[model samples]
Target: MTAVEFDAPAGLTGRGAGVPLSRWAAQWGMAVLRLLRSTLFVGIPVVLIATIITYGLGALTDTNPAAQVLGETATPADIDRMNHYFGLDRPLVVQYLSWLGHALTGDLGRSYYTTLPVTDSISQALPVNLSITLLAVLIAVLLGGALGIGAALSGGGWFDRGVTLLCSAASTVPPFVIGIGLIVLFSVTVPILPSGGYVPFSEDPGRWLRFAILPAIALAVEGAVAIARQLRTSLVGELRENYVTGADVRGLTKLRVVFGHALRNAAGPAITVLGYSIPQIIGAMVVAEAVFNLPGLGKLSLDAAGKGDIPVIQGVLVTMIGLVVVSNLLVNAALLRLTPHARRQQP
Candidate 1:
C-alpha cells in the first residue's frame, strides 16, 4: 500500500479524526434533553403529591391559625376576620389552589406568627444550611475518596482492614452524637472552635469558617464512611475485571491502570451514594443544627412545626423536596456522562 493509504486507515481509527465535532455535540445535546425529560417526569408528580399532603396536614390540624395570630383577648369576630383574611374560611381545595398558585410565583404566604413572608424567612436561613451542607459534602468526597482508594489499592492488607473497621464504627454513630462529641472536644475541652452559632461568610470569612467547620465535620463523618465503603467495594470489583488485567498486560503503570481506568469505571455507584447522602445529611441537619444552634432550614422547620406555623412549615418542606430533586437530577446527569452503560440504557 502507498504511504497515504496506510496513514489514512490509521487516521480513520483515531477518535478525534473519526468522529465529527457536530456528531459529538449532537450526542451531548441529546443526553441533556433526556436528562431534563426524566427529571420532569419524576419531579412534577413528587412535588404535586408532597404539596398536597403538606396542605392537607395543615388544614387538618386543630391549631387555628387565626387563634395563633391573635392573642387570647381577641374577640370571636376578630378571629373570624383574620380567618377570612387568610382565606381559611374557604374550602380546602380552594385554599390549596390559592396557596399553590402563590407558591409558584415565589410567595409562600406570610408567617402566621411573625407576619413576615415565608420566602423572606427561607432566604435568611438558606445560606446557613447551604454553607454547612456544601462544606460537609466537600469533606466527605475528599476524605472518602482517599480512604476508599487507598483501601482498595491495599488489596485486603492491614490498611484495608483498618479502613473497614473505622467506617463500621463511624457509621453506627449518629451525626448529632458526633456533633456533641465534637463540641466537647473541639469547643469545650480545646476551647478553639465555637460550640454553636453561625456567621455569614460575607461578614467575616475567618469567623464563618470557624463556626462552620465543626458542624460540617459532624455531618461529614457518616457521609464519608458511606462513600468510603461504597467506593472500596466498587473499586475492588472493578480491579478484578478483565479490562484491568488487560490494561496491566498492556504495560500501563499500576497507578494509571488503577486510578485512570479502574476508578472511573467504579465511580458511578459511589456518585449515586453521594447523591442519596444529601437528603440524609439534610435530615441529620435538624439535630446537628440544634446541637450547634445554626439557624438553618432544619431548625426553622422544627420551630415552625412546634408552633404550627403552617406557611413556614410548608415552605421549608417544599424547599427541601426541591433540593433533593435537583440533586438527583444532577447525579443522574453525572452518571450518564461517566458511565457508558447508563447512557446506552437511556431511551
Candidate 2:
C-alpha cells in the first residue's frame, strides 16, 4: 500500500503557516490595480470638466475680480491693468489651462483676499474636515450595521418595530437641526463636551474628540438611520431567500444561517448604498463644520465664498471632486471582493 498527497503549486501555495495568505494577497492586489485604473480613466476627466465649468462661471460673473482685489474706487485703467495682471484678459481656455497646470503642480493660486496660497489652505483644512467626516461615517456604518442585524434577528418583535420607527423618524430630520438639538442637549444642559472648535489631534486627542463629537453626531445620525433601514431591508430580504430556507432545512445552526449565510448575502447592496453616500456625507460635513465653527475645509469654503475668494473656492471644489473620485474607486475595489459575480468578472 502507498499513500501520496498532492500539494498546491508554489505560487498558489500560501506563503505563511498554510493560511492561503498568498491567494488573498493576489486578489487584493488585483483589486488595487483595478481601483487605480478606474481613478485614472474617470477621475481625471471629471476634474478637468469641473475646472472648466467653475472657471467659466466665475469669469462670467457680474462681480469684478479686480474690484474685489483692489477696491470699488479703483479707476477704469486700474481695473484693466489689474485684470491684465491676473490674466483675466487672456482667453478663457488659456486661463483654465494655466490654472490647471499650476494646480497639478500644487500651485492653486493665491487667495484674492488672504494672499495665501489656496493649495496650502486646502491642505491645512482638509485633514481636519476629513477626520470629522470619516469618524462620523465610521460611526454611522458600525452602529447602523449593528442596529440592522439586531433588528433583523429579533424576528419582528417590539424591538424590531421600535427600531424601525426610530430610524424612520431620525432619517427625516435634517442634520443641522439634529446638530442644534445635540448642542442644546450636550452643551447647554449637560455642559460636558465642547460646543465646537478645532484642536489638533496630535496635540490633544481628548480635546479633539470632545470638540468633534457633537458635529459628528449631527452629521452621522441621519446617515446612520438610512443605513440601518437599508440594511434591515436587505437582511430581511436575504433571510427570505431560498438559499437561507435551504440552510435552515439542512439544519444549520441559527447563528450560521443568519450571519454566515444571510448577512454575507446582504452585505453587497448595503455596501453599494454606503459607497453612494460619500458625497452626501461630505455635503453634511460642510453644514456640520459651519455649525460647529470648526476651521475645516467646509468652513474655509464658506468664508471664501462670502468674501468672493474665487481661488480658494475653486481649490475646495476641486479637492471635493478628488475626494469623491477616490472614495468611489476604493468602494468599487472593495465591492469586487465582497461580490462573487464581480470577482468572477475581474478574473
Candidate number with greatest lDDT? 1
Tell me each candidate's TM-score.
Answer: 0.91, 0.84
Q: Which regions of candidate 2 fall more than 4 Å away from where they truly are?
A: 1-42, 72-81, 241-253, 345-347
TM-score between model 2 and native: 0.84
Backbone Cα, N, C clashes tallied per candidate = 0, 0
For residues 1-347, what per-residue lDDT tens digits would candidate 1 score against the true structure? Answer: 22221121111121235567776566667778888998889888988898899888887788898987898999999999999988889999998899999988989999888889999999999999888888998999999999999999998999999999999999999898999899999988999899999999999999999999999999999889989999999999988877667666667699987767788778889999998887788778778888999899988998999999888999998898888888788888877667644543555
lDDT of 2 by residue, 229-330 (tens): 888888898777766666666676989877665776677777787787777888888888878888988888888877777889899999998888878877
lDDT of each: 0.85, 0.79
